[model samples]
Target: MNAELVEQYRLLHERRPDYGSGASHVERIAAIIERRGVRSVLDFGCGKGALVERLRARFPEVVVDGYDPAIRGRERIPLERYQMGYEMVIANDVLEHLDAEGYGEDLLEMGRLEPRWLFFNISCRPAVNVLPNGVNCHTLVRRPEWWREVLLACFPGFIEHGSEWNERSKGWMLAMTRPLELEGRRVAIVGNAPQAMGNREDVDGFDCVVRFNNFVVGDGYEAVGTRTDVLAIPACNRAVITPRLKRFTEGVSYVLDLATAGCVQAKANHGKIRQLLPHATIV
Candidate 1:
């Protein structure tokens, strides 16, 4: 990683409250709480502390803390003694940055805390903008099933939450899971390539594409010259207006746009997809 580029990310702690290049991922955590109450919350890699502030504001009753390895500025939690146990631990765009080396220690530290749940987005793909050689910010992006397996191994007994391609809008996957299992945890994908999910049920892909602005909003559309085998959000949400409950909505918008784009390379085997989603591929 370029020093200038790392500094750029630091500055983003100002203008880019969304984190991870407009994909802050706070809403997913917020969404998790909607399903279940979290008494303690930790925002790992909590840049600029915006998402941290958001959580403190919304769930004031719940205890919250912020952790980031890159931050050199004054942080809410002292750098050394920052790690503590919590009910919910959030690692929005933090895990992929671990390719920098020594990230395993950080992972073990979090494990020691043994939070009840881990909500985060791992890099599904890397951005060309950062690396002139065609590399991205992340180094360990295999596939969705691979990610699920890794998370389950790291913290077993937790219900697998969800993963969505944050490709066009950015290159990451939005994920969430809890310690105690839920009777039926749902996956709400907003993209077109439902087949990538392997599970034909909850996977949703569509036949159209959605175009957005610089901020990346879901607006107009384009035709699927080929197939619309992806999941879509607009088709399901039924309403255009979504609660701006947090800064991470932009990331959600990007995932939605990717879904509409029908751009996933991996095609889902209908049987395998059925095991994952069991709902039905939308496209």
Candidate 2:
């Protein structure tokens, strides 16, 4: 970001309480965190740290840090943390505000922090606000393909996501992750039934153990086992959304919501389930 643009945003944020909003992207971000099994996150260009605050609230177990040159509290980028890197790094509605000449360096910085994954939401249209110098806030506005080329150049094999330029939003989103290998791993899908009990030793011996919604092993540890690598929930069913799911995530590496299961309202069901289970990964 340019020095003048940074000052302009700082002044704007100080004056307008709603100038740098991030709550709206929490659900989508949460889903990404769950899908990627991201334990630590760096919120690059985190204006006012709203997204960081919300992320901490939703995923208390996950570590979330924020940075932005304009924001007072989030102005300083932790040099040590950046060197350590993060499981996931997110930049929402922040890249477009950068000066075109310098945004590439900022993108490179984000890539450095993302050893595992990088999530981005970039605007491809002009912003409503103008700086004191009469220049639009979104100076680096460009189409999705342009952004794709930039990302590919920085991080090869990055993938584009569901986001597209909308009349109202005017931006696109992309997500990328390092390749994973799980072909030879032993995986056990345990159901919430009495029949799946009494094999605790065998279940725990697997490389990965998966369970279904509302699975209980309180006193039945000898039966169901305590280890849980993944949790699968029925996204279309409202009854399945419960607080118990939160307790299961401590040892769980992934939480999968069967959002695409054959249903009349699959898309709507997915959205509703995501809102209900904000910590679950919809598939």
Candidate 3:
């Protein structure tokens, strides 16, 4: 922890300690926890323990804990309490308080908590609140992209939910979760076009080639290459599913678009197509 930054926060807390009255912030986080099925949560830099209390009251089953270095008494708790990890780690309006010099270290420390999902509500703009020295309480104010880059560097494996501006909070809330690695090694989406013919070598190089509905292969084998890893069938083309098309799907993985799966299943050649690719994954 940066001593100087800590002192800045301590001074800021003296002036404006409470997070103010509003269940919107707490409710949003609660909704995420329920949606993600997060059983445990650690609210880092939880000011006044408002969110901690709200989460506890809202979700009795979930194990909710909070720690804030700046706040005193019950609001401030030891970090050692959550050494193992939590299902989700929330750092709402906390990162901006730290100095730019110690920002990376602060993020690294948060990463060490080893949460499956990280919900970061970062304030990109300057804060209305200020420290005793008249300096803005948000010391390390940065754009959402800058925060995204830093977060990704600290936690590489987590899949980022695109940054969205929240009008109510006037900040960017970034949600990242551990992704399902169902898609194998390398994936190249092959579009059905003339350009795809010229890009055969590039397409063939990928571990999986995702081709769209009724894609031609035999006629343009030399140009398009002979590797069909996954075939995507769109519902609009279900009427055109012929015997030749069923044969075209031989020995290839199938990616059925749910909207079109019902239509595709209704086709005469659907049985043969199903027989060819016994296990088809729906997208």
**CA lDDT, every prediction?**
0.50, 0.73, 0.68
Better of 2 and 3 by TM-score: 2
Q: Give the residue spans of candidate 3 off by over 4 A.
A: 17-24, 74-81, 167-170, 181-283
Q: In model 1, how large is the Cα lDDT of residue 205?
A: 38
Q: Would you estimate the TM-scores of all the predictions?
A: 0.50, 0.63, 0.61
What's the true lDDT of residue 40 in model 2?
Answer: 91
Q: Candidate 1 or 3, higher TM-score?
A: 3
Best by TM-score: 2
Number of the candidate with higher lDDT, 1 or 2: 2
Candidate 2 lowest-lDDT run of ten: 272-281
The parts of candidate 1 lying over 4 Å away from their true place are 1-23, 73-84, 128-136, 139-141, 170-283
What lDDT tens digits, residue by residue, belong to model 1 across residues 69-158?
446653344433345567677877666655544555666666666676677676566543343333454645556666666666766545
Write model 2 residue lDDT over 1-283, tens digit each, in one string: 7687789888878877777875456777788788657799988888877888989998999989999999887886687887788888888888898878888788887776755777788888888887666788788888888888888798764433334455677768776655333456666667776767656567778766767778786574556777876666675542455465566566554445555455665786566434433444557
Residue 153's lDDT within candidate 1 is 72
